[model samples]
Target: MLRFENVSKVYDDGFQAVKSISFEIQQGEFLVLIGPSGSGKTTTMKMINRMEPHTSGTIYIDGKDNNTYNASELRRSIGYVIQQIGLFPHYTIEKNIAIVPQLKGWNPKEIKARVDELLELVGLNPEVFANRYPKELSGGQQQRIGIARALASNPDIILMDEPFSALDPITRDQLQGELITLHKKLNKTIVFVTHDMDEALKMGDRIAIMKDGKLLQLDTPEKLLHEPAHGFVEEFIGKHRIIQNPELMPVIDIMSETVVTSLPQRSPEKALALIRQRKITNLIVVDEENKLLGIVSAYDVIKQLNDIQTIDEVLLPAEPFLFDSATAKDAIIMMDESPYGMIPVVDERKKVVGLVTRGSLLSAMSSQWTDSEVAE
Candidate 1:
């Protein structure tokens, strides 16, 4: 829970780094600040932990003025991670992570437990990495350690300033995914700063676009993609960029309304016959009220035709289904885990409304590219 009220930062020589930006971050929200160099994105983040104090306006953390707390104490209470992971070369990974908790006067046993837990949380083996020095690890590992150290004290808020920009593309992508998982698992309010629009869209619950020391736009990734408020915002996030973000497309637009469904009580022979007649790969098994029960694949129905009395006996678990309100991105992500390359879309009452198959999903996404090309 952080709020900035027309916040500005001016240096002693009168260089205005931030120009009265006002925004509020909800609890457990992943808010990203993005802009080009000298755009005050970093300065805005620093002002949160009082690393660079704001020159004008008020900053409140947890409903209280940030200035009410001691600067050193405030810094210690919040987690901070940077692109250049500044881990001490001589200190062991365990010591580096334990610094924050140790300074907070946590007991040795608690600090050790916390360090080991954080190491595993960042996907590193504590037994192997805890005693190793920072230099002993690779760049990605060091960045992970930096993250672990930042999270050492289990702070409620974390500030990440281009934390993954320095890693290789593959590693950067991997770390981005890992950090996303961590954000959901930890549910900590994260203020991430990055210059990359792709990374911002992938990471942020809401993105704040800044330019020339002013806040230009602040909105959800979907809203920003569809309706950029400013000309500069549109230029910054190009048409191609908007097309690339699958979250912009509603799942309903790509899903098929003609879903082949069957009652769970249907005989295996009849269900197989229906599957063949309809040329459908899977049958959506439902109740008398049309609520989804499970899915029966044609392969399974044929295999178990003589072995089972009813189609329900060979039913596969209906998982990874999306609500009608979901997005194309949700379908895209869940498609891999879906059996038979199909995802059932359901309504508020758990009734099957539509289905998203691989074919339909691909077709919709391909059309986005075509549209982008035509617009260009």
Candidate 2:
């Protein structure tokens, strides 16, 4: 819902903070701007709310020029969170969260209800935290309060400037997970800025890598890892480190494309024959288009062999499948968490493309470690 066109910002000292950069952010998408300290990622974000005006070009929010809106109005319509957890020390948590609604002229009753609702939404008990001051809360709790404050008015977009950077690693990880859950629930377009690659990869739908005030590469995390745009992109991604770590490798890299399948309408006898021929215990059931239907194990088919005529009659629901875009680490964790022996891997359309088994993971990990040791 937001678009930037040839946007640039030059300081009065003749320094260009942001070179002409253009990108679009889709509605409900999490886009991350990542770069080093002098890369101007923050400057680009500030320009959106007019906190820092661009020296040239235009920014549009929801199809209207951002400049056309009054500065105060534009900012209030967009939620903002910063690294410092900017909560007013003098104000109680309830008062801190109610700032925006109060300024919007909400009545006392509405404001009070909103404050309580927001506190609960952010995982804080209204009764316990409502009267507490900012200092009374831990850093992570304070950060949640800051987020609640930002969402006080239910803005359609949120801008987060390294919001979790100051917390300890464990707290930062928790907040990141919470933010992802919140984004799914709220469906708000979020533009997050961070210098940490891991955070960008975990949280962003698309990552924008910047350097020297210029956009370098913008792509999904999968593409960014497998098909970097240039030498700079490759080096910046820490290719050697990724190659050495199987966890960083995408599932597609090691998944077996030779998946055995049975049509949902196939007879149980036929499906069992296919499974035995393939020397496998289970067969993935699919439709005419090869889209995954579910799975049918030999044990299930045998149990119902005399009673059931078709595989459909004995088909069991498929275990949770992984997308091709997911990392090997994701697959490993998912497999460990479940009782399934194998997980089907699918493309964006949920069509079965490959399969991942415990054997494949062990082989990939072993090969990667060997390669790393050889390189060393």
Candidate 3:
């Protein structure tokens, strides 16, 4: 864990890169520092590893003053990654990753194992890439190598400064997802810096917005979007404002629990009778445990009524469904993209729990809008 107390950084020419900023990073938390250029976000992060020394105030790492430890020793204990990667050109990928471990006086066998383990952890094949030079890999591959290097020592905290900014969109998205999974698996406290709001929202457990060498607001992504503290915060969160609203609305809030369903082993006559009784077009097909199998429609049953004896023969492909914990936005998107009129909501074991239809989405949105208008 890391904590900053009234931290400020000033240059010799009288320029203050950072104001007195205070924050505590809990263990296993992904904290994103975001702002426009020159907002002191990077400066604040650099101060943690002593990359940029604080001119005033104190920084503590694991309850000890950062200044008390030798700078090299402190930095070696903390993993640092930058946008440029900074991998040594002449070093093989394995050597690049083993720099810290080697410095820590690890034996050759231990260092080799650690290098292989880190390479695999970042989705790289150690056998193929262990001897490859940095130039032999793609930009995304190089960035992954940089991450492997950061994790080589298994540090408790990792500092990332725009590590994925240079890659293409698809690659960047992949790396972002990998980083999230990696964070959960490693459980390391990460301080990430980015100027992109979408990245901050998707990756950060909490976002800290800064501007002009001062901290503006720090809150969870939902709160930051719905309840911005200032006009600058609102402007900074521009365009994706809708994400703040619908993400909070759970699928259960608007789903219809009276879904008509048929058993997979049922005959076509039985399924057709239920469909006609319910006056619905389609029925979700489930097994004995109510776990989703597929879907059956009245038209299919009628077509196969004479040809086949069971509903399984007339079953139609099921559309992609949603989990009970999914948000309204997720349901809306799934409905918009799919041809099915309704999406079955499932539990952890894929048992049908409820159904979310287009009508339900519209009703939910209409209610939300009306409430907002009345509040205004």
Write the number of the candidate with greater lDDT, choosing between 1 and 3: 1
lDDT per model, in order? 0.86, 0.84, 0.84
- Model 1 stretches astray by more than 4 angstroms: 239-376
> Ten-residue segment with the worst summed lDDT in candidate 2?
359-368
Ranking by TM-score: 1, 3, 2
Give the alpha carbon lDDT tens digit for every residue of 30-120 in model 3.
9999999999999999999998999999999989999998999889999999999999999999899999999999999999999989888
Write model 2 residue lDDT over 1-376, tens digit each, in one string: 9999999999999999999999999999999999888999999999999999999999999899999999998898889999998899999999999988888889999999999998998888899999999999999899999999999999999999999999865457557767887898899999999988778877889999999889999998767876678677776766433333656788888788999987888888888778767777678898988888898876668668999879898787787789899988888788644334578999888899999874345444333434765587
RMSD of each: 11.4, 13.6, 12.0
Specify the highest-lDDT model's number: 1
Over 1-376, each residue of candidate 1 has an lDDT whose tens digit, in order, gives 8999999999999999999989899999999999889999999999999999899999999999998999999999999999998999989999999999999999999999999899989878899999999889988889999999999988999999999998865457557767877888899999999998778876789999999899999998767877789988877877443344568778887788999999988998898778778766778989998889889876567657789998888888789799999998999899767645679999999999999875346444433545656776
Native-vs-model 1 lDDT? Answer: 0.86
Clashing pairs in 2: none
lDDT of 2 at 275: 71
User: What TM-score would you give candidate 2 relative to the actual structure?
Assistant: 0.69
